[model samples]
Target: MKIVREARHRISELGKAAAYSKFGTDVARRILASPADSVVHKYVKTKGLEGSVRRLASESLPPGLYFAKLTIKQWEKHRGKPFRLLQGSSVVYGNEVEPPARGFPLEYRNIVVTSSDVTEFKLDINAPYELKIGRGAFTTPQQVKYDAQYGVKQYGDVFYSLRGNTVNPKKLLITFPGFGPSTSRISYAVSYLKDIKEADLRDTMMVCFQDRYLAAGSYMMVDSAGRSLYERVWSVLDGLRSEHNIDESQMLFFGASKGGSIAINYAKDFPQAHLLLAVPQMNLPYYFNKPFFRDNLFRNNAIRSSEQPESLLRQYFAEGRKIDYFYTNSDELSNHSLIELAHDVPNLTKYRVDGGHSAVARAALPSMLGIMRNFLHGAKNKTFRCENIRSYARGGNVLAQARVDNQASKIRGANWYLEGSLGRTKFMHLLTEHSYQFLKFTSDSQVLAAAYDPIEAMSGLTALEANGSRWTSSLPEPLTRGPKQSPGAVLSFDELVLTSTSPREYVVLDGDTHGKYRYRSYEVDPAGDTMEVHFVKDAALSVDTMLEANGKNRTSYVAVVEPLANWNLADLVALRFVIKAGAERLRIVLHDSSKRQMAMALLSQVDWKNSQVVAASPTQPEANGTSSAALHEKEALLSNAR
Candidate 1:
């Protein structure tokens, strides 16, 4: 156990060390100069006698030559006006405001800036300097001396690097790494090309950047100097493409969390830019309440008034953004981000992988690599899913077969990784001898396995347990795999489809929600017309809407979707209730556009052994335009529960 933990720690260290090694971006082009010695910043130019005093690193005035004010202020006055920086007494020097008459500061005094700009302001003393600036969002480095004391290097501005073959490549993969432990160093998430050996990428360029802001790092597109990190990233990409003559179709952006946000934002304007993002927070300002972010990054005027790529995702997707978004099914916040925005993504691929937020990378990275390899080799689009993992008892061992839906594609080579609760990893290339294949393993400990197939798509982490009961699930119809053969139907952002959904089902809510985040992922609130549903714990769905029964309480997880108050659903509506596995029964009340209950249906879990009906006939509408259906408690999926 100790060895396993120690191994993980060592691997982590190696990852950090990688930044300073061969994988490091070229730092020769520094965006913001490393803080120079003996420099004071953020001195306010005051119009009056006594203004707000700004202090420097070393406060004691040990007798210095002449005072040179850094004169830091935003260039725009309509955007914002100017302020004053005072040393001791105001000595006018043109419209530059007044500085202490030269050669006077031989004693202890902090620098002063007249005017209130609550953003991060810096002050230092040569003999005491003045700072003058107007209102505008800006960013400055935290005290360099303090950062250096911890042996952590810090860069104050957005920095990026472009490196790779840049020759004859199939696609250029732009990787945006997630947040680092600190914003001090430039972060690089895993670069797929480094591990790839395909002939196509031997000449493609990989670009990455640093989060110029602090704490959870940067907002990706905004820098403190009021520069558009968004425009800059695009410009860099355009330059590279122009220089290399690469087509737009051959570009891809990859990132998760913070990196995911940037990757999504960068490709917004460019419809051809493909995105592979995992568990990304759609809104940047959402994290501002955290002390670190609030103190260092969000408070700046530049950040507050900057062009937010925050919620523009809906607009981008509305204008045809091809995004492959991945999120852990159990993570409510990330999932909610998707539910709130523009509906019906043009070509969006969603993966409801197992585990929490941290586990997204494990699923996304391997899948990303496979997609990259596919693009390089000109492979068809394919997605492999572990549709089921059931425990089959043979002798005293519980054998499990992970039914992988390969979409009937030809498999060239497949590799699988298995890890036990103790952190032991095993690899295999098991061949499918029959339509159903079971991997044999029997133990009291927990185990997870991933079939890392290097195809157009792959599966996320799946777990198996020993001595667990077995169950079977039956689909009502053939599952649709969106390819050239069958048409794929997409549910819009405004559409009321959660998780795995079919085209035969649809619903209309009463109202719309704009910029309101009142409910968490665990809370199911169908307030007014908009539906806000969240899973309790491990429940989640991506592409489908069918739900299996829970042995304890299928109704324990309640979802309330709002209904229209005056529109009839008959003209455009399809609805049904289907349950599998353990759900005892489910009762749904039919509603007219006027929000009146007309009929009801009760669905029970399929009892394959008895071959019994799992669905109930809808009750006839009541004469008063309202109907009620009741189910016995013992046989109910949701009898009295709301």
Candidate 2:
């Protein structure tokens, strides 16, 4: 009976081996046999990171375990066919209904744990697909080690984490991280702790601002009856200067995008601090992501022109500040503010790269750190090709122009990458495949990336696609010459600017700040500046909520105002913003109905004063600030001023 049982067990083992052999053969035939089907090996080689990674195509291996390879574009096109995720990475997942907005998380999309069920189920996507998925994109950071190495220091709502040589450090670096989902570490720049140390940077003490005011950051510019975040940061930095015994000259300010803007703003007071900014959003008011940030940070949508890089950068006129703006030609909105600022800025070093706005910050980081290393050694970095990028908007179409001081340098034939608000998703459904055109050669100094708006009256109506963005190629003039401009009001740039701001307050872009370089736009009472907008109800147009609530808020106040100009925030990174107000709080909520948003101010915990009471002090700008001017742009375009 025992011999019979042993024979049966051997037979069972042989059967299992045969089943494995059969399944392996089937996987090889389906994936490795066909040239169309890439054997998605669960394992492939990579650099820096261990284990398998992904690239384009690879030769077939003796498939022990493999799946299929296809792109969302390929599968989406001929969808019914069984294919895979092929080209430039796009997540193929289930349960998640995220709009795949730019900079969205990837871990939730790709990862599954042991507690998960992997049984037969119909995919959400109405098509079939396969994948030889590599190890998931989820990994735990050494939190215990990092926690011991770093300690946080908070001042009011503004705070920063200090790391590196804290004991009598030679050089100091204050880093600011741009907009990243706060599910992870808010001190993202701290992740580069190891990288900066290994670069042989001197005994440097690094300061990484958490900047996680509401979500990610409020630009660290909150002010109340108490000391403002600015003052608190000032006190902290002033203490650090004495603690580290390092002056502004020996310190380096580094940031990318939003972080860069903050660094630039702070560095205005300390021009000696070397600045390394990348694709920074200089004009906060006109920023595409302003609504999300504004709603999160401000009490009202009153944006201060003072809260911009251009205003801060202009302060470096008397003294020289080694300001290096590591910018990518592709960052469209950022260029609008940066290019305009570059024209008048002195001792400004601009490093132009060819990459995306979000990606270029990280991509340019190594070079940015090298600049810090140079400061540590009191050396100069002359490696990067320096050039200035300028953009000119005429008849609603913008032309990105490049210039260089070096006659030997070729700016004409360099690659200039450009993308509009809609990026690649414009072609998502129409073409059944989605991608954006990024590279345009400076190969011809004459090459230009021009933006065309069909909706801009008859701004030629050259490029037209229903609900789609359009950027004309590197054509010298009117890209692929189409329609002639219809007779319409050709508004100058100043007029366009005037229309956006209040008529009563002529915002002098280059206003005199007496002596305070930090004080930005000064509202000079332009002789008899008044607007007759028959307000059925008392109303005022104010952007102060979006910027700073200078003085105290009056308890007796109007809850809301009428409409102003409507801003379309659906196309850019259309993340829905839901307003959750506390009891007895007044919040200006943007109810997105068919992509249209309500432009309102969040006037909670705010004190206001009537304009009639402050009429005596018309010249007093902060007095004018109390009488709020709110823009309401929901369905009807109107404004309310009180």
Candidate 3:
């Protein structure tokens, strides 16, 4: 036994000498110079690759040599591990042995890869399998599973292309595609693969889902039963987690346009996942009205009525989940409702980019990746601060003074806007200005100030009022009231008189009301009747009617007015009227001769005492019907007509 041990030791020593001679002195230097905690040492110890290491010299030690030496059982053990350290071995082996060019065939584990052309390869995975490829390889293998009923259909293809070493990946990124089937699935996978490389996310798994098209060539995720496609998506993700043993906390969902809508919807299920959306259609009702989705509007509307991203976001916030939004300043795909939804969701992080809707993804990619990295590494919430906001009313104008301190490294400038019960206004350009004096003339009782960085576009509203009273950041408090002033000129309507006459030019307020000056109230069931018009006999000859809303129907008032032949009131700035109502809010709308809405305003408690109807100019018609822009033009037209 001693003689045999000596012979074996001699042979091992001779083999080591041969390896040293073949690989040169670099092998010894590398082993001696390597730190104990280095990846090479760790891979060697954990993988039990001491023999492989002893056989290889530093100069000839091919990339991924240790992984290449792993047996079937050993490889299965490290299947889900991060690929950063072992990815180099994916290339061909450098020594006498020639590695498989096509890499590990799926057939080795009940999976098959078939290729019509060498360029594009189709993979049939009997069960879920891990796929690892080089950094920029275009031959992406998408897993296509067969559904028993759907027999060879493409519906089961909505899954991610798994990359990297499957052994305990650091981050898992799931991407959702935009509307329609414009690009192939391979291109989408390649684009995200490049993004992963650019971010240097070493131990990462990428997931990309294909949007299925309907018979009408429209992207439809909702079934006939009004159920969302997110259910299937969640099921697939759950399967992936179970099969590959992925950590749920390290997941992220990203998409643009319609894909953004899906991401927002999926975010409700995975509250622990970090959501990233670009130019997302938050309101499906608004999206249904678009030209592309017009044909299926009614069906889509039914599905949208049940579930909306805005409502889902509220639920997500309730569960302590946050979302990251990337939108363009001039996105035609987004409407006022979508923007308002993004603005109101306090937990959502918004990033605004310049250019059209399609450019948002390209422009915001770098910053989006950085945020994902920080989130994966358990970084704290990154936000700026706006302090010392002093607001006071000066006559009809409210002036505000504040300072914005940028705490984030990526944000260079900030934009400011005012949000009130009336509505949000356009964001003012305050990218460089820190100390700003924003002046706006309005009758809104309360207003909340907000500031956002241009780069990341994450915004924060003023939580503290001018009086130093603390309020919720999500729901800001109103501004303080100013000194009261005398009332303006009032225009009073005639009393409600009932008269029976033939060829009635004006409709009687008691019962017979038709043609122009026909008033309708939505508060009553059978409208336009005698009982609908309430009469009050007093010194002021006032009228009182209850305006109550029930369920989906809102209280409204509509009055038809006849065109004046020669009368002119172009010089008048506003027409004021007295009103008293128990309801907290009301909307006053004015229509032209063609029944087209010309102007409108939101009346609150402040406007109840002195309700006014002001005409708006052509350029500023949306200024809550306060005044008109073409005042001189109207004056000239009135003089010439008279």
Candidate 4:
């Protein structure tokens, strides 16, 4: 046993040395800048912080700078007493309470005590509580003692690496594999966990282990086993924390696929730790009981039971729970799970993108970083809702922006179109398996919308169709039809335009919003086919009515929209919108004229509903109405002439 333990330690050291040997001197210096104080180290010295450090380590990477040891400990025992067996009946044919009926005539029995043993390996590091430092590994072995406390038991292997520099205090991310039936193959989790920790992230450490093989992918085990494993993990974490000064918040739990489920389970048990996971099998029952996947029991073991995913989620309501779920629209395992969870847990955030089973690499990582950054920076509520839409709009130049809201629900980010750009204004928003692209155009009204890879089109938003169409409409209304009614008609901001009297002032001669109001404009265009309009508004601004014009000319018109309630426009008053006469206009027959024209013409007249335009006929003085067009940039505004 000593020899085996010694060999494992030597191998670990050798591996570390080899890794260090590969780095340039500069890189090596960066990794080993300076060692920080560790609560775990002190705890280990007094054996006081073992459990705490172990607890912290289970969820995070060690903070500051440090190294860790991955070692195996053997847990076994022997029983000296003879074990007894139960026979069918007691026969007293011969005498002396005939030796309990052996089998048939002359069947013999021997007394022997059944013995059981288990193996558990621990991976750890000593660090401050604020910066949990340590690694842990676990796995299920084949042919484990059937009567063992936990059906299948074995600890995984943990590997260590440095993160963060003297300049930046780092956070640790520790990953746990879903299930494994052996120690050898289970170590794969450890290797990959370390690799991912090294990329892109600067001030973070990663610790992980391979999953043990269970049939094929089954990782579920009896509750007793899970508890025992959890306890062992908890013990190591306790030790690390008591000895090290690692803060619970600095530690993060991250995992993917089967590992992701493991991460969630750990966080559910220990809510104080920061948790991050992608495409976790939260709904394990659905995964295992599926008729099509009936043959697999290996990975299924780690997430055993035929219960609903809701039942599994119910296990996480212990006191204070903070967990983040990342899933791709293509992730069959977690896509729906995330949505369902999103509805219930306010703190639960579902990061959706475009991708499949391998959601982490394709979708979760890139998007997750932004979320983690917010979390690490002490963001309140820390939960963000994201959607896709163009946010950058500077007279044709548009960039994608990520819209986020604070705890008070106040929005943050530049305004472009569609109420903060539907939260998809940045490259960070993941809406299914695709990573959204922020778009901008140098001149045209066009903006870019793209994904990392192909994905199903959003329900209301169509995927790029034939000839690369930007959007496909599915609503019952005409996919390309204009608003049926004005005044009462609700239209999106992009659908309306306000003529700018100056660069900073605007009047709505034609708009879908209700109310007579003035607005502050950020931009104006008079030379292009499409003029850009940016304005500040209040509730009083609104559209009155949109009317379709009769006649083969196919021209449309609209009426002056009145406010539901009167309002005050302190700075700019009224509005005038410039549009591609037909694009933003509706076909409407207004009292103003029999001929069809742009909706702006009817809306610009104060008595647009009662006045009429004479076609070469003498106009009656009573037919005249008040005109507010000249007050603003009527030059850019549509004319009342039909």
Candidate 5:
């Protein structure tokens, strides 16, 4: 019996070997003799990430295994054939029923998933042709037609992991994009559209504030009234919170430039709303400051502004009083004036950056987004960004001197380095960017005098008081006219007096104290010649280091010019300087959103620490403060960025 079994096994093995030999020979011969199909040639290489990775190493190989001569096209072809196309409902009874007749015949479309299925069914897009398996109709013309013509036909499967239950929806980050005057004209256009499915951000619930009257093609301003227009949309948001299941506590407000101003004003008026202001406008004075007679649009409307410029501006200015601006170092339009107003009002929080008007967008986008998420969800301990003069000055090869401009004489100084050259042109660029008024010296005169425009008083704009207030004796019109003198000796006789006519405000700029100095003499002639006396202003002038002339004499000043509502912030960080006297009299106060004082102190001499100041007075300018220990923490706080 064993011998008979062995004989059968041998016979079976020989038969298997013969079959394999024949199959191998046929495949080899076909490869060697037949011309390759164009489809196969085209599939010679792969594409995309999967193809690239596969070419580098096969999934089946060990970590160190070597892959050789593998083409990208060949590997990608493994996924050949388009995604499955489904037609007609897969319901059990769907195949048995006849499609109802109508203007368009009721029909069904089908999708094939597997290779075997594709082979069994064929796609014939010919006229009036029916797809038949046996003979019974399976689909309706309307259903099939809709699939072919209207449905999202080309996109692959979109899987959404439903996060945060419907009972408690996740916080909605409403980012209001700031378009120019022409674009943000209406409520619906500028709002984030809810129907776009092309991007993953589709779920973000973004609303754009676009120009309603003028399309994106025509750049124009809407003159009807931006405030009223925005209020309508804001009312919609209120409805969403009250009527719908919106997570009201999780709503975040974001804006830049004009939009920033709107966000801040809206939040200030509606303190109950959970909104994070990212680089809010310093003030709304910009719109009225520039003359506008061009066409402005409203809802399905158009109007020219030649008739009511003053009245329209008056309305706009009234709205400006309601906002609490938080700007940054990069804000060229409203940084200086915003910071000035911040000192007067406690609600404002200011930040500083190194970029232009878009600095907050560029530097603080991620941080602002995170904070907004927290604020909307009722998260606690949310922190914000503040300005860092030392770091900013380092970027422009300049120095920063900060002081408390209150009536007290408390002032301190520190040295800083701005990144750029202190050459003549660069200095002027910094001035314009920061809105620093140029002291018309007529020539390169050491004695610099700054003039002022009366309108500056209305806007809270401040510059050094006229040079007339800081001189004791008459000197040459331009210091260049006088003979050169020693670094310490007086070259020209000049009087120095400090006065504040607009308001009793302290000069807020770099280099106000006497402890640190880059150069020794106030009016020094480094290359000495025969000169009698050099006239000098009070050493306490508020001149930014970057704006300081780069001659042999490097003496700078910090004058308490009239207070301003807003000034360019980008220019402030670009300045740096060293303190030569009055380091003990410096004080900085940090305020909260309620127009209430939160923190105060003398400016820190440390590089980057959480510095605080004690309220030397029991009450602040607004009659709100406490008697607390004077503390200075030398660290960066987002809350102080403005």
Candidate 6:
């Protein structure tokens, strides 16, 4: 029995070798002749299946076929037939189906189908089709149709589709699509379709490469040795150039997200090629560390290389290759470090627009087209700059200044305007020096200025107050006001000092009263003739003290006063004195019974001026929180002070 078993095993080995030779392919031969310890060898050994692996060796097997069981009769019948055999559904072949075509009739003449007890069969030989089987099912018809229409090619682990007229085309557009599942390639296809259709591609050839390894294996662009997957794309492009007689100089690479990174990677290679990237993930290593992708395959790959696109683009920048990059402020997936890197690249033209990573492409298509046209026309580089000229208050006028910088073009004129809830009003004309100043009515009002070029076209728009104030000066005299005084209360500072029962009521820095106030880096010297508060450091000095009136809270500081007191003083209001040391402006706050804080500013007309006095009316609270009589009295006092 042992001798018989040995003979059978030797005969089976010879049969396997003969099967490999008959296949006439290196891959088939290699897989068939693999060592017994190899995965393929072990698989065949355990499954008691030798013919199926040999037959499927020439073609890429669907993921499901790894564990499929084929009957001896089925293997004999289907062997050498060059067909796609799905595990459970149907066997798809080229142009012909065997007898007994079952199931409903189809519409297209090229495709034939039939169902049986064992399996179903389909045949379509007229068109080139992509067979991608996952688990136990064939890919969707939509994907198969797309692959058939466009000539899909698989290189390494990536599957890409290339479609366009290559005969004497004016340009070549290569698009690297964003990532998706292994079975689906339409997520980014839909994004590129609009651009592809709108693009003047009659003279352009477009190629789209899909990122398949992201789904099949968790392998990002880098290999185990930290090399980029872009090398493979380059090889493919080189092959296309050689076969189609294409010029690499007129190429434009476009991508978004992951695809955008690939576009940047190869932008330097083409030299003369242009790039249109939208919210690209330029820093792969940094992106992998993000919370969204920390556990994905991209993170795993990043651990190996520590590679980032910003670092890689340094060489590209040194080569002086420019790229047109579009990004939105709202893209959560985009890294700000990458955006800063792109902005720093002297050759790159950055466009910060509206929308997220995907929507921005559609939102900025019109601008993108203009940029593409300029590139094609070989127009000179142009940049736009608009900055605030610095706001100033002088001669009872609150002037807003805006400076327009047309880097390369001459400004014809500009329409200086103020935009607010009242609607836009064109107020002043731009000056010859490209600076315009207009009178702003309210101190809180913002200035909106727009600059136009020779064509009366708006070049740029800027808001003056966006970066706070560039200059600080006093407003008109009428804008400065002290707190309102009571109707008939009058108290002298010396008289109050003698009559006050609690010293805390009047915050005085005496010789032993150091902890009376919160002194922030300032000391009060009682030895001086008058109490002098001086800073130990050159920094600003400030002191804060809390006050209470009728169970309400109020806070007073050296630089500002926030009065929340609502005391029912029968006829007298308290008085506070502030002595100025510098020409800095002081802000004071007063609260109504509604608890709303209203700011009032007092400007110093001269430095080292005498002490200034401010007074506030005691609150006369009513059912509606404030009395009309008290409001009228307070308004009168404020009007008098102003």
Candidate number of the best TM-score: 1
Instruction: Rank all candidate structures by their TM-score, best first, as comma-separated numbers.
Output: 1, 2, 6, 3, 4, 5
lDDT of 3 by residue, 1-642 (tens): 999999997997576456545344455336524675898778776887543453242222222211111112223343322211112322111111112223443122111111112223212212233442211112213321211111212223233444544565666777766652211222222124344552344566666555432211122355322345566767877766666676667788877776777777766656678787777765565445333233233234345455666566557655656676666545533522234223334455554444567776765555565566565444433334454344554553334444444332223322233323211221211121233232212123222122111211213242211112222122122344345522211111121122212111221111111111212222333222112121111112212233323333333322222222211211110111011111212223222212222222111111221132322233332323222222222211111100
Against the true structure, candidate 1 reaches a TM-score of: 0.42
Candidate 6 lDDT, 580-606, residue by residue in tens? 111111222232323322211221111
List where candidate 6 sits over 4 angstroms from the true fold.
1-141, 155-158, 180-192, 216-228, 242-247, 290-292, 302-306, 341-344, 370-642
List model 1 lDDT by residue over 430-471, tens digit each: 122233343322222212121111111112322211111111
Q: What's the distance in Å from true for residue 521, model 1?
A: 22
Flag regions of model 2 displaced more than 4 Å.
1-150, 153-158, 182-193, 223-227, 288-291, 298-306, 317-319, 380-642
Q: What are the models' TM-scores?
A: 0.42, 0.41, 0.39, 0.35, 0.29, 0.40
Q: How accurate is candidate 4 locally (lDDT)?
A: 0.32
User: Which is the winner by lDDT between candidate 3 and candidate 5?
Assistant: 3
Q: What is the clash count of model 5?
A: 125
The sequence of per-residue lDDT tens digits that candidate 2 reaches over residues 1-642 is 999999997897576345335443354333322342233532211122222111111111222322221113223243223222222232222221222224423122122111111332223344443333321222224322343355543333354677777777877788876765433432233324455663354477788875533223456554311123667777777788887688778788887778877888777667678887777775564453332232223232323324456556655533656776676545645654233223323556455454467766555444455556566654431222214333444442333432223431322212222321211111000000012122122332212222222112111111111112121222222222114434222111121121222232111111100000011112222221221111111124342222114523322111212222223221111111111111121223222222221222212111211111111111234324333333332222122211
lDDT of each prediction vs. the true structure? 0.37, 0.37, 0.37, 0.32, 0.26, 0.37
Tens-place lDDT digits, model 4, residues 544-583: 2212134322222222322222332211122122212212
Against the true structure, candidate 6 reaches a TM-score of 0.40
- As for candidate 6, its clashing pairs are 95-125, 102-114
lDDT of 5 by residue, 1-642 (tens): 999999997897575344334343343333322343544223432322222221121111212211111011221232222111122322110111222232333233211112222233332211222333210112223323432332211110110111123233344444443543221111112323222222323233333333222122111123112112334445655644554455544455555654554454444334433444445433232221222211111111222222122232123233433222233433433432323222222222233333455654544443343343334333333111111211111211222221112221111111011111111111101111121211111111111111110111111111111111110111112111112221221111011112222222222222111111111123222232111111112222221221213443332332222113322121121111111111111122222213223211122222211222222222333234222222234422323311
lDDT of 1: 0.37
